[model samples]
Target: MTPLSHIRNFSIVAHIDHGKSTLADRLIQSTNTVAERDMKEQLLDSMDIERERGITIKANTVRIDYTAKDGQAYVLNLIDTPGHVDFAYEVSRSMRAVEGSLLVVDSTQGVEAQTLANVYQAIDADHEIVPVFNKIDLPASDIDRVAEQVEDVIGIDASGAIAVSAKTGEGIVETLEAIVTELPAPKGDPDAPLKAMLVDSWYDPYLGVVVLVRIMDGVLRKGDQIKMMQTGARYGVDRIGVFRPQMQNIDALGPGEIGFITASIKQVRDTRVGDTITHEKKGTDTPLPGFKPAQPVVFCGLFPVDSAEFEDLRDAIDKLALNDASFSFEMETSAALGFGFRCGFLGLLHLEVIRDRIEREYDIELITTAPSVIYHVYLKDGTQMDLHNPADMPDPSTVDHIEEPRIKATILVPDEYLGDVLKLCQDRRGIQLDLTYAGSRAMVVYDLPLNEVVFDFYDRLKSVTKGYASFDYQLEGYREDNLVKMSVLVNEEPVDALSMMVHRDRAEMRGRAMCEKLKELIPRHMFKIPIQAAIGGKVIARETLSALRKDVTAKCYGGDATRKKKLLEKQKAGKKKMRQFGKVDIPQEAFISALKMDG
Candidate 1:
């Protein structure tokens, strides 16, 4: 039997930019998980996109050998999880592999909404939580206040909160010691029927599907036949290996150990995270609990400006979804924009990550439409269908009744912005649910439709309150309401390019604002362009912008052939970058700014 003193399993959780990754870096360095000279910065965040975004999207597991002050070596399995709500499912799944978590709190930004959300998730999983106040080195930090908030919210006495600077490597040794003392060792019956959970999986061009799992009940070995509880798919385990944190692999991982497994599985879908894998004949179960994907709360369509990257875009989504099961897409075509996809996401950030990955990672240029949330439309017979796609909506005249998705929104702001914040919420059809004060901060809650809150609300809240407002929303059930679908028309033809749903009461204001923003965004090309907002058959607002009348009209000369070639090459590149909307060639930055809708 292996000794309990040799094992340790834990995760680090915190809000975005709360120094979770930086602290993980310090822990890895102190533990000597990677070599002193050969260590890469943010080593756990090995993905290029993760490093660029400064967020941990995927949960990473690393095995490090740390020597306690008692002079005993321990095997510590450190798991790093994503902090964004978009990857909440991924975070919870990663948490299941560990016995405890380091709840890193920012001293300056005391107890954020996301921090509370994750702490509750940890509590639900029954994992031991250790609070740590990070960024003690920062000038604005108030460690005492943050620790009090943590203790109050978590229902744990955080008087022992470790104050550490992951940047300067101060007080890290004590934090390491706390993990060894405060967190309990993983306890499981290894002699029972073999059972394990698939926590993470990745696809390699040469190795096929590489799965990471935590053995919960029994010992697993090579040549063992395994069945997945979620899919009922069976496979013969080819090999078992324990993590060395880097590339080196070892044989035979035991219970409480974090490691990888290889099987006859070829596709990423076959090896899903949070699915139960058991000894084939010894254990049989169907539909594993805790594996259900979180339903997408927002939907949007994406199309290529060039109309040729349609296949490329589809392939990119497929490749990305291999690692990211949360992002979903379906084929769609518009008369205005040839072929596209209607993609579903958990929230706005989820949509942004997928869109950014497609363009920046896969090298595909895309034109994305405004986002739409699911709307519940009830039939006369009481049958209800959730409408995620705008095309799925029945004609307004044929519809019996329409109900839009609502969210319970909570905003934290300075005391001065309380009045303005209420006015902003009222304008967006928000019903004031509650209002309270904690010290000098104002906390306001509103029940607003998801569709109403998805667009420009974040920016508006920040602008009206001088950037002191922070907001978060949890989806509430749909409510019956009066709303209108607004569309933008170019010339006389309906443009699928510009479409949104607004409440009937505020349709005129929204439509006019959108058209005015579009007029400023659409560039001048070879002909004049007209931007018009229409509701059904009537045009509600119109704006006109002249198109580009002239560009380069110079000819190349043989005497200055190199310079002429350079100029022509530059023009071609410029033309390729500009997207042709009607007769106007709009730059990519214009589309980004239009999405923000902030002049």
Candidate 2:
């Protein structure tokens, strides 16, 4: 067994597309964990979606055996974490499992919004942060400028920061040496009761649920009875292993070691992330601290394009949810959408990832409604309720006040595009808090409603800044707002899934735009259809879909004017009857298109 003092647990934290996965590959290769012939690009990222998007959605852990120049062998566990703000919870979980972090920044891009956000997280976790400037091999790399930016933005000492080109394997050995000497060693008692933290888990068809855990104290062995402190679920460990780039079975894992524990667990829900695991008979007096379930912030309705495939969609969601604990779904029915699931996600990217996985992995087409953020409804009766869907909102009169979730957003962009970006934020009801400059880049902070940014804010930000702005945000609690729920009506009938909560001042304008967009999407029917947007009993905006024309007059080409008039009257009568009794067959695409509004 490796001595506790010889083990160093650390993770790599950075912004998206900052070569985090590449750096991880360099570290693995430099240690000779995998043979050169067997090594592949982004070997730590196992998911096809991750590789295709060039982003890490999941946190991956690997143990490396390295022989330092001090003539001592060290067990180095590297937990590679996602860089996107959507997976901030995963980063926090990984931080809890490690003692230090390698804060990576691109030499050309300097410190971005996500990089600052993650550095703050590492600081909050009390982890030792080692600043690393990456991609120095690039032509635009200014190592000194980036090091100064890191110090100015992150308030860290960059004099000792390592500069390395992960792509060329330069300065990799020095990085490893820094990890051994600079980072603190993990400290835990081997004789104490078994206490481990489940940072992540996944469902394995062959081995059941594989739980990735960091052993804090005592030892965990195969066949030992383990119980989850949060759920109180008990199971005998079926296997114990560590990731040497891949799963390698081990007899036991002790304190300071990061490994997997399989206990024939059938469901991923049972093996909760951020939960504590302890020996059934030798459990600790209290479970580990800082355990909380992930809460989804963005929500949308997902329906199979063909209603007949609802069951297939349900099964697919369950299977996917087994691996993604941050994703949540429940059964929901809509007048326009028939039957579907109301799914919740961490953020927009998380929502997109889940949607893509359902379509690609399950081979099922889906119709996703507009995404919304959870709102808090306060009633005059001194009661509070959480509103996940706009359709579930109570009458405006009954609501004394409504509070919407807001976020403290930080954006980093080139100084030249600062005005345009600031204008975009202000248009979205964002209140500018501060603006500072880090060299040629400007860091802008704002307090904006979460719902405002959930849809097309990022895309628009990219457009305005010419893809140079980087954004990061965190929940800043809910605040009271002049909010009202706007409903869409087709032929005088309301569609629940199309309802949206908007500021009262912009409700009429938004409603008008929604109706206009819907008119373009809904196909012409035999009867005239009037699409109206209303709040409560008052209609604010309306659009009409003209009835399809027929060749009723063509048949009477040789007849007199009286015959033509008779045919026209009959056609009008038929259309009237159809309007009274016939239901508007709004196509699935119409609903999706109507709610696809970015502004």
Candidate 3:
């Protein structure tokens, strides 16, 4: 077993596209952790979707052995975490498992909104952070300016910051040397009773559930009976291993070591993230303070395009849930869309990735409803309930008022695009909290409704700023708002899938946009269809989809005018009768398009 003083645990954190993964790859390659022949870009990102999207969806870990200038060998356990706001939960979880963080900043781009958010998380975790400036090979790289911004914005001293180009492998040796000298070693007592923190777990088809753990107090070995303190379940360890970036079996994991263990667990839930693992008989008396469970912020419904694939979708979701603990779902049905599941996600990106995975991995086409945030609905009788779907809203007469979830958003943009960014926020009913200058870029903070931002706010922000703006936000709790559910009707029949909640002041405008979009999307039938958007019983917006017409006079060549007139009259009568009994068949494509309102 390795001594505790020889082990150093740290995580690499930065903004999206700021080279966190590249830096990790360089470190792994420099230490010869993986053979050079097997080297690949983003080696830590094991999923295809992650590589295609150029994002890290899950935090991945690896262990490397490096001999420093002191001529002493050391063990470094590195956790590479996602940089996007949607995966902030993954970053925080990784933070708790390490004692220090390597803050990577893009020298070409001084500072971003996500950079501040992640750096603060490290600070909150009481991590010893070492600043590293990346992309120094680029002509636009400005190391001094970024260091100043880091000091001014994040309040971290950057005087001794290391500058490197992760793309070209510069400054990698210095980076490893700094990790050994600057960062403190993890402290743990190998003789103490077993106390390990379950940092993450996922389902492995061949091996069942594999858990990644950080040994805090004692030794964990193969074939030993262990207990999860939080869930109070016992199991015998089947295998013990460590990631050389490739799984290598090991005999035992001592204190301050990070490794993987298989306990013949049937499900991932049986080994919850952040749970304390201890020996079944002589375990520690006090359990570690595990983090709170992840709370899904956005909600939506996902249904298979082919109703026959509902069972397939269920199987896919079950398999996905075994790997992703943050994603949640429940069975739900819609009048127009048929059977589906109501799913919850951390953010819009999380929802899209899951939908895409189900479609691609499971080979099932899907239709997704409008994404919404949870609401607090209070009744006149002093009772409150949580509202996940607008279609399931309670009667307005019984409800006293509705409180909508709001968010505190931070946006960093160049000075030239600041006006457009502010206007976009104002149009979304945002209240400006503060605005300041960080060098040439403007940082603006706003208190905005979460539902408004959920739709097309991010897209609008990117378009208006020409993709130069970086944004991040967190839930700011709920506030009372004059919100009401807007229902869309086709041929005077309500479509529950398109129903959504909007503020009373902007309901009419939003309703008009929904009606106009639906009119263009829904195909014309034999009868005229009246499309309306209504709040309760009052219609706020209306659009008429004209019926498909046929030439009735074609069959009456050289006949009396009265014959043509009679034919037209008969056709009008038939249309009227058909309108009353007609069942509108909304094609699957239309349902998907209508929900993607570009306005």
Q: Per-candidate TM vs. native?
A: 0.88, 0.96, 0.98
Candidate 1 local lDDT, 258-353, one digit each (tens): 888888687787776788888778784443365566678789988887788888888888898787666678899988668999888888878888
Residue 291 of candidate 1: its Cα lDDT? 55
Question: To one decimal, what is the Cα RMSD in angstroms of model 3 from the true structure?
Answer: 1.1
- 341: Cα error in model 2, Å: 1.5
List, residue by residue over 480-543, the lDDT tens digit for candidate 2: 9999999999998898878999999999999999999999898899999999999999999999
Record all residue pairs in model 1 with backbone atoms less than 3 Å apart, i.e. clashing.
524-547, 524-548, 525-547, 525-548
Compared with the true structure, model 2 gives a TM-score of 0.96
What do the candidate models score in CA lDDT, each in turn?
Answer: 0.78, 0.92, 0.94
Order by TM-score, highest first: 3, 2, 1
| Rank order (by lDDT, best first) | 3, 2, 1
Assess the local accuracy of residue 156 in candidate 2 as a C-alpha lDDT between 0 and 100: 94
- Where does the lowest 10-residue lDDT sum fall in candidate 1? 576-585
Off by over 4 Å in 2: none
